[model samples]
Target chain A: MLKDFFRTFSSMIELEFRRLKHDRTEIYSRAVQPILWLAVYGPIMGSIRAIPTGNIPYTDFITPGVLIQSTTFISIFYGLTIVWERESGILKKLLVTPAPRYATVIGRAMASGIRAIFQTFIIILVALIIGVKFILNPFYFVLALVIIFFSSGGFAAISILVASFMKTRERFMGIGQALTMPLFFASNALYPVTMMPKALQYFATINPMSYVVDAVRSLIISGDLTNLWLDIVAIAIFNIIMFTLASVNFKKIIE
Target chain B: MEKAVDVRDVVKIFNKNFRALDGVSLEIESGSIFALLGPNGAGKTTLMRILTTQIGPSSGHAYVFGLDTVKEGSQVRKLISYVPQEMSVWTDISGYENLLIYSKIYGIPKEERNNIINGVLESMGLHDVSNRLVKTYSGGMIRRLEIACALLVRPKILFLDEPTIGLDPSARKVVWEKLKMFKKDYGTTIFFNTHYMDEAEIYSDLIAIINRGKIVTIGTSEELKHSVGGEILHFILSENGLHEDVLRELEGIEGIKDVVVSNSDVTFVVNDAEMILPHIMTFFNKKNIFVRRVSITKPTLDDVFLKYAGTRIDVSGRLSEVTHVRRMIRRG
Candidate 1:
């Protein structure tokens, strides 16, 4: 059973990779937004010191946040593909296969994570060019990669869960837009969580994206392993819950 | 011989109120091509889904090779493949890539995968275009690619829902030809659902006529046509108009089984068109109703559906005569 699950997972990832190869322009297009944030928004906000970042420069502090933001955007909109697949009959074809339902769900969620990872590479390259300093530790970088993958995966699974109930792409898009901005703003992606109101602080603490940004920031910028366990545990728990719900509800799209 | 599929009194109700399949029961013999012929909303897809284990029947049972579809769904999935009614291939990917994904999904070993994919592509006549993106291919090629994906595992039983819908006549023929070859080569039990009377009559070894969630009749094409048991005498009357009363009068004549009138066209299902044609001509002559053209045809599956289901199977307005005949049959 485990063998079958991994095979299915790898096959699905390979399928997405083939599709991505055919459309390499998407990678280039997706990099535009994060570059804009780093080059334009980061400079303007950093010069003004609009948000406190202790000793770190504002541009460097927001670099990881920008990466998480772009990753969240890519991951959350992944459900649109599911809706399209349902419309085009591809989902039906996949569901009829002998693969277990959970395998299919996780396979697709991981595929989205890989796509987000591609975007992560672009953002980090832009961050380096813009003079954002990192601690230069290979171990911290690897941990940050793992955190980005699983956090993007959890967000993608949430998107799939929404797709299982939202049959139409238009409705899914509406919900996706409503979701992405709020999740970005409620988290500490842009401003410090301490600066937020009490109600918003509660949201920031529970928001999975905040943990993702915090983990990534600590690993890459401060090289601090403090709270790294909390960050990893929180993201892991979030992924487990989201993946379970998404897999259980995956068949509902066809119904 | 063992049955390939056995569906016993299967019932599928949707949304608590709509009964899609009231009580569908039938058995398909192993290694034979079986077809479920029905009009739209006739529950053909519903029944196929149950057998494919995509959905369980609300009540009763369905089995593929004696394995309960609901309980043994995983096992049944291992032995069968399905081509759904809609276009199911991934258009953004090349045909080879699409087949490769299915081959992996079916768990064909890595070493044998290329050979099997190549074999199916060649058989489906898609080898030349296998490297091309599917969106660039014609509708027929896309469908053939979908079938090629299904054939990757060489499944024992293959189910297709509306396998050739919305294709040109030539495209439809090409699809059926490939399907026939698959059945002959592998002895796969091919079960498909279609509303095309000609397809069901020509290709299927056994045809089941389903309407409104019920199997109206099941038999070989010849048997179903024989059960209708009459020739159709069709005539288009000349400019002289005939009243409804005169048309009804023809039904009273001996040897005339049924009379249907649509505009100036008159059709009579008769015991003997040779004997009844003379009477029809004499009656038309006496009334000064000149006949423009006349032809006698063997009762087709359309007539069989009209006889048994009390409705015409094709409602696309191509066969208006059959619809009129059905209305007359319903009235009597």
Candidate 2:
């Protein structure tokens, strides 16, 4: 049974890989966004002020946080791939096949995380050239990967939840942009959470990006642990809750 | 005999309150080439979609190759390959790549996919067009590719919607030959939908004519042609006054049901054109009504369609559509 599940999962992943060959949008947006945030935004901040990020170079402190942000943003549109398929009659094609929907979901999530990993590497390479306080510690590096998988997948589930109800391409795009941009803006996108106003801080605590950004912020920005477990726990809870919701919605629409 | 497709009281209503299909029922015998003929707003596509398991019925049930479309949806889908009417080819990809993607999705073994793809492509004479992006392909090549995609699965039943919509005369002949080959080689039951009467009449073993979301008529072309019974007498009138008087007398004849007198001539509906046509012509000649043109033709399926739908069934007949077909593959 486990082997069967793995085969289905891998096939689903392979399906996405096939789609990626034709999907050119990822080459531009996923790879370029974090590099600009790091090489452009990070350097401007480090040169301008002492910054709130301890004494370390601002680029080093901000690199992982930006990487996580980009992953979440990119992954949240995993459902858009479905929307395109549904619009193109490819969804009909997929539904007719014997492959399970859960495998489709998990496989899509796998694809999203892998793409994010590649994007994160690009940003890291750009940061290294720009003299950011880069971390070579394998433990923290692995931790960064875990954070991306959890947060990116959770965001993708949310995307799937919205995409399930959409009937048109415009509606899909509207929902995708609506969820992604707000989460980015509400989190500690450009500043430390400690610097936020009281109401903003209260709102930031519940936002998912707050947890994801905080986890990456702790590992790479502060070079120390502070409430990392809370982010991990919240992300795990979000993953389960949203994944269940997405799976249910996905089944409903297809049926 | 076992049936390849059995549908009873299938219905579908869109969320926007459009009643696409209203309780459609049909049975297609195994190995028969069945043609579904309907006007633009008719429910043919909806019925096809439900049978293919791409959309579920609002009510009632359907089965393909004995597998229930709803309960055994995966199995039903496994048995059917739908070639939708639209230009569904991948514009940015080669025809070969498109076939490869669909083959993998259908879970065809690698060797078989290659063999089928090569065979189907070569049969369609599309092996030369397989390398270029589909955007550069002509209308006929694109349609051939659509058929190629559907055939990759070696399905027991093939559903083709407007499969010959854009083909030229010669390409259409090539397509018909391939369809005949497909059935002869695979014993595949073809459930085809077309507005082109020539395509349907010349190719199908059985024909069902639908109008206004209902199947008003179903039979072979010969059966439909003889359904209203008897023969048809036609007269083309010029802007001259000689032929009208005799046609007026024939309008009052006992067995005639309809008379259309336009300009200088009259058209008569009769129980037997052989019985009434010569009498009318003789009367017109004796009375000096000047018969310009007269012909005896049997009632056609086109006449039956016009009789029921109040319109002609031309593949290129322009539709100022009250509702567009669902913007899906082959307009859904």
Candidate 3:
């Protein structure tokens, strides 16, 4: 039974990669936004000294937030493809297989995580080209990549949960649009929580995206382990909770 | 007979008002080709979905190989594959990749997936187009590709909903030949729905006619025709202005069970058409009605469907659907 899960899971990931071969535009399209912000917005905001930055360059401070933004944006639309497969009857075909239901959820969530890494690489390359530099350690970079993957997984789980209820692609897109900006701005992606109002600070404190950015920023900007443990613990807990919700809802939809 | 599928009083209600399958019950023998006949909204697809474990019955039970569909869904799913009505292929992927994806999904050993995919493609006569993206395939090739994908698992029972809905005659023939080969080679029980009356009559070992979410009748082609119990006689009057009168006289003839007149044509049913034909001719003569043409034929599956559904199986005729069919073909 366990072997079947892995086999099916790997195949689901393989299928996603094969599909990605045809969607070359997706890479450019998702990368364009973050690259623009890094080269354009980051420099403009840094020169104006618009926000508080304690000795750290504003560009460097915003780099990790932009990376998290790019990764989450790419991951959150994973459910749109699920709804597309449902329309194309691919989901029905896969549902009848011996593959376990949890494998599908994990496989698709993992695929989004994998895809988000590509976006991460793009954002990082663009950040470097634009003269944004930070402390780099191979070990910490690997650890930061893991955090990004888990963060992507958590967002994917939320997308799948939304899709289980919104089976139609159009309606799912409608909800994704309504939720994307709120989730981004409410977090510490662009502005630090200290810069937000009291009410906004409460939301940013609990937002999962904030922890992801915090962990990534600590690894890259300060190489500090001071709050690293809390970020990892919070994101891991978020992953567990969101994946459980996604699996339960996915099984219900297929059933 | 070994029953491959057994459905007992299955009911499916949508939105608490629309009854999709109303107490449908049927038993299909193993290794048999069973054709389900129904109109557009007759619930045939809904019933097939339940048997294939895609959905559950509201108030009754369905069994495949004696396993409860709702309770042992995963086990039942392992034994079946479905070809839904829509074009299910991934248009952007090559036929080879499409089969490969399913092979992996079915968990064929990684090493053997290639060999299995190649063999199925060859068997379906799709090796020539295997390298081309499915978007470039014809409607016929797409249908055959779907069958090949389903065969990757070598399922014991295959369920197809309208397996040949909008195909041209040649394409329809190709699909049927491939299906026949599959059934013969592996003893896979083939069950499908089709809009063509002749298709059901020519290919299926048994047929079930469904109407308004109920199984109206179930039997072999010959059995269904015989069940209606008579031969049909048709007479075309030569614009003699006496079609109504001739129909009246023909109805009164002894042994002529029933008569119907439409557009200068008269049709009637009789236990023995040979014995009744001479009288029908004489009545037209006595009334001096010119008989333009007359023919006698055994009851057809269309007649059987007409008897049960109160309408011709292809009541709108295939001509009217040519444009719509062309659009689906173009979509491929």
Question: Which residue window of length 10 is worst by lDDT in model 3 chain B?
Answer: B323-332
Q: Fill in the DockQ of model 2.
A: 0.21
- Under CAPRI classification, how is model 3 graded? acceptable
- Tens-digit lDDT string for candidate 1 (B1-332): 78999999999999999999999999999999999999988999999989988889999999999999999999998999899877787777799999998888789999999999999999999999999987788878888998998999888999998887766789999999998998889999999999898999899999999999999999999889868977899999876446878867888899988887778888888877778899889998998888999999987888899999998866475335433432332222
Q: State interface RMSD in Å for all models.
A: 8.3, 4.4, 2.9
Q: Write the per-residue lDDT of candidate 3 for residues B238-282, one digit (tens) a residue.
A: 863355554576667789888877777778888877888888788
Q: In model 2, what are the clashing residue pairs, if there are any?
A: B86-B330, B242-B289
Cα displacement (angstroms), candidate 3, residue B116, comes to 1.1
Q: What is the C-alpha RMSD of each candidate to the true structure, in Å?
A: 8.1, 6.0, 5.4
* lDDT for each residue of candidate 2 in B132-211, tens digit (9 for 90 to 100): 77667776787788888888877888988777765667888888898899899999999988777888899999999988
Off by over 4 Å in 2: A1-12, A19-26, A47-51, A77-81, A105-110, A137-153, A198-206, A214-237, A251-255, B15-18, B85-92, B165-173, B233-296, B313-332
**lDDT tens digits, residue span A1-255, model 2:** 455346556665564555556655774667677788887888888788756877767777777767777888778776776666565545555555555656566555666776676667777777778776655677887897778776777787787778778866689888888887777767776677778788888878888888888787777657667689888998888888887787667765543
Worst 10 residues of 1 chain B by lDDT: B323-332
lDDT of each: 0.88, 0.74, 0.83
Q: TM-score for candidate 1, please give it.
A: 0.87
| Cα lDDT, model 1, residue B63 | 92
TM-score of chain A of 3: 0.94
